[model samples]
Target: MNRTDLTAVVADATGLTTHQAAEAVAATLAGIARGMAEEGSVALPGFGTFERRARAARTGRNPQTGEPIEIAASVAPAFKPAAALRRQVAAGRPAEN
Candidate 1:
């Protein structure tokens, strides 16, 4: 679901106002971004781990022209689900530790 829907759910679950839930969600997203930027990773137990992965420079063919092009290296963010999360998804059940 989108942020608004998620905020509403959080508000209902926590008995928080909509504004407060929105702030909480926004703060949580900002914190995750900050952690990824500063430390290159963040791990939430029983959920998943987010990390920065480096991509190597390589040559790629230009699809239209069939010409070789140089691709610059870059770092990209990635996520790996924890075993519990994976299992829950696979089993179609709620996540558990």
Candidate 2:
């Protein structure tokens, strides 16, 4: 779901107003972004980890013209789900601890 839907869920779950929940969600996302930018990673127990990963420069083909092109190296954000989350998704429900 999108931000609004997520905000609604947060509000319902936490007994907060929609506006408060929205702010909370925005702040949480901003914190995660800042953490990734400054420290290169953030880990949340029982949820997942967000990290910056390096991508090496590589050659690629232009789709439109089939011409060769150089792709510059860059750092990209990535996520790896915790084992609990992975198991929950695999089981199609919350997994028993």
Candidate 3:
């Protein structure tokens, strides 16, 4: 499901209008980003932890030309699902809180 579907679900669950749900969803994502920028990570209980991962510069093979190319170092966002989340996904329903 996409953003619109998610917004609808939020609206149904919270009795909010679709527009309000959309704003909430957007704000939630923005908050995560801001948290990551300032703190390098965000943790949500029973859901997951989002963190920044750093990659070292390295040489990569050019698949088409079979030549080596330099790969730049970078920091990327990563997620590790909480045990509750993993169990919920495995069981096809949310786990008992």
Candidate 4:
């Protein structure tokens, strides 16, 4: 769901004002992103862990030109689901701690 829907759901469930819920959600997301970028990872219990991984530089061929191209190494974000989350998904059930 989009941010608006998420805000509504949170507000309804927590009895908070929509504005407050929206701000809380936004801030939470910002914190997670900032943590991952600054610390290279963040683990959320019963949810998942986000980690930064490096891609090695390599030579690739361009499909259109059929020419070799140099692909620069880069850092990328990766996510590993927590055991609980993985189990929930595997069983097609609602996620729960």
Among the numbered candidates, top lDDT falls to 2
Q: Give stretches of model 3 more than 4 Å off.
A: 95-97
lDDT of 1 by residue, 1-97 (tens): 7999999988998999999999999999999888999999999998999988999999999999999999999999999999989999999996542
Question: On a 0 to 1 TM-score scale, where does candidate 2 land against the true structure?
Answer: 0.93
Go through the candidates in order and give the clash count of each. 0, 0, 0, 0
**lDDT for 38 (candidate 3):** 90
What is the C-alpha lDDT profile of model 3 across 11-87, one tens digit per residue? 99899999999999999999999998899999998899999999999999999999999999999999999998998
Q: Put the candidates in lDDT order, highest first.
A: 2, 3, 1, 4
Comparing 2 and 3 on TM-score, the stronger one: 3
TM-score per candidate, chains pooled: 0.91, 0.93, 0.94, 0.87
lDDT of each candidate versus the true structure: 0.93, 0.95, 0.94, 0.92
Best by TM-score: 3
- Candidate 4: Cα lDDT at 56: 100
